[model samples]
Target: MTALAGDRLPPPLAEGDRLTVDDLALRVRVSGRRKRFALTVETDAGLTLHAPEGRPAAEAEEFVRAHRAWLVAKRGLRERTRPLNPTKRLVEGEVFRYLGRTYRLALVADPPAGGKVNLIAGRLVMDREQAGSPAGGRAALVDWYCRAGRAWAGRRLQPWAARMAVPEPDLEVRDLGRRWGTYRPGDGDSSVGRMSLGWPLFQLPMHLVDYVVAHELAHTRVLGHGADFWRLLRSALPEYEERRSELDELGRRMWMGEMS
Candidate 1:
């Protein structure tokens, strides 16, 4: 949340902050230590310009112009690899998955107390009134995922924590934007930690869900995705690389509450 370039340059943003070029919609980052300007295309197709502190706006603009050709090609490559999460229609017989099992939407006239989805007889029984509208159906379905995912992850957390030999952190399941899961370390003396998983993760197979949980649990012992972290995770799950690949491939295609 650094500075965005405007007519007049504001004071230098905090070290290593985001500056934006409105024309290209690419971000400009200013760092005090940076001596040379560099261009990078983020995995998510985000363009970034790493420039030294107090660089002129015109100069930055020129740097971007010089690299426009390369930028376009790199961006195209990134766009091809980015996830194309499909939207749901929220109608009768619409397909959904829960832990790798397929269930068709079955709208029922009579809904229970709340508009939560029920897994009854291999069908996702949702309220017809609720599913009549895209907004309501999307909300109801996401709520179901959050509540159900919490319980499932809660039961599965302790076992993974025990296997990893790390203290179990508080777990939450909800929309985490583009990330599958995240973990924040707590003070060692009293706090264990905090872990969050996107509700959409529940749509993946159990093994992949377990992979996300275990991946976060490993952070309890190791911080970054460095060699030490991978080594620690490998000790617990020998086939972690395979699981990671599967999750990456399958997770992107999972339903993310988008409606048609």
Candidate 2:
């Protein structure tokens, strides 16, 4: 990218080329539909400048320079919210979370008669046999999360769907690796969509969980995270940006089946 003259624009960037903005390295993404430059700060604090196709590199540089203050502030926030993917041990007093609340792990001699694990007296109780084996304990805990997450998400779906004015899709909680949630629209013989939320998402606070629910609901009407999709989401969750930021901060710390 180079300084421009008269209506001329720099040659389009190559596949792996980077956009250089003084002191800041930015990835350039040219979107034909975008009317103005858009700057994105990712969860990892990576920078991307989304520009309308054929915009001069100098113009993009000026835009980034003008918004340097905002980028700096957002980078600071991202730095403060760095990833903390902590591993867990099945020993007593090991912490677990359910809907943003913490509960300690407790070992018991006998299995609770009905299940591999149980929330007894605000502690996650597992029989000695299960807790003694990390693999067994982890499987039992994830099963609990899947069951609990499905039940809770089931009850909350109708209300959020109503608020978003979209039909509630069939909800399933499972291990959707690297994604908090996903919506699969119906096809072929099925007319109803199915929304799959990761079981680990159940460990976040209710508000953050709701954020993901509403987010997928928005997809019920709009598929991509384009302007229209965000606009629809904003209409339903006015404070979605804040919720998303909080989710980015705390979600990385949630236990994702890692055991020690």
Candidate 3:
């Protein structure tokens, strides 16, 4: 199941039992007070529901039946937005994007004595290139991407934070799969003041990357995305709605395989 942001839980339900509006294929949850019934619908496109607790099941079912067409359309839209998974694994000859352009992975090995990987010319030349051994080559490439991402994220965020009236946020670049970035509120004297930026090697644009930075920075003042949290964010980024969609689309393509 997907997540609902900012204190938006399915309208208060009873014992958490669910009923599927068979006519609409929409899922309804009965919860909160025994008398109160909540509705939750699942569609990949997004969530849409009309919840009225303390209503009879027959009444709730009728409401869902009336919206059957809308529910179907919503599910179809969500399915289209799901992340794409390629059948082929990442390897040589595979195309990957960086800085708005695409590059093909090429393996080459010619070392003086020790192994090293460097971006020579336009290709990723590996000093330990063994056709059967892709581990070393992959490590070199991932390291390169991490370095590039850290520099790119810092440069883009520094100026934006300053202009928005937020304090300078320290940067920590690391590989985080579950989350993209986070803001850490400083404790007392010795605590470090900073933000943690996660750089997964993918082709997301600079504006979308900055959105995450701005999102965390706003947390410094308004810990949650209540109405005030959104207002604070809009003050810095007026077009956040568009940016959020872009990130969701691009963030899905990022690969996170461990290098051996």
Best by TM-score: 1
TM agreement with the true structure for every prediction: 0.71, 0.70, 0.63
Candidate 2 residues lying further than 4 Å off, grouped into runs, are 1-82, 188-190
Q: Between 2 and 3, whose TM-score is larger?
A: 2
Better of 1 and 3 by lDDT: 1
How does model 3 score by TM-score? 0.63
Greater TM-score among 1 and 3 belongs to 1
Whole-model Cα lDDT of every candidate shown, in order: 0.86, 0.88, 0.62
Best model per lDDT: 2
Question: If both were scored by lDDT, which would come out higher, candidate 1 or candidate 2?
Answer: 2
Sort by lDDT, best first.
2, 1, 3
Task: Give a tens-digit lDDT track for model 1, residues 19-82.
Answer: 5555576677777889978899998999888878877766777788888889889999888677
Ordering by TM-score: 1, 2, 3
Q: Clashing residue pairs, candidate 3?
A: 13-31, 13-32, 14-31, 14-32, 44-78, 45-78
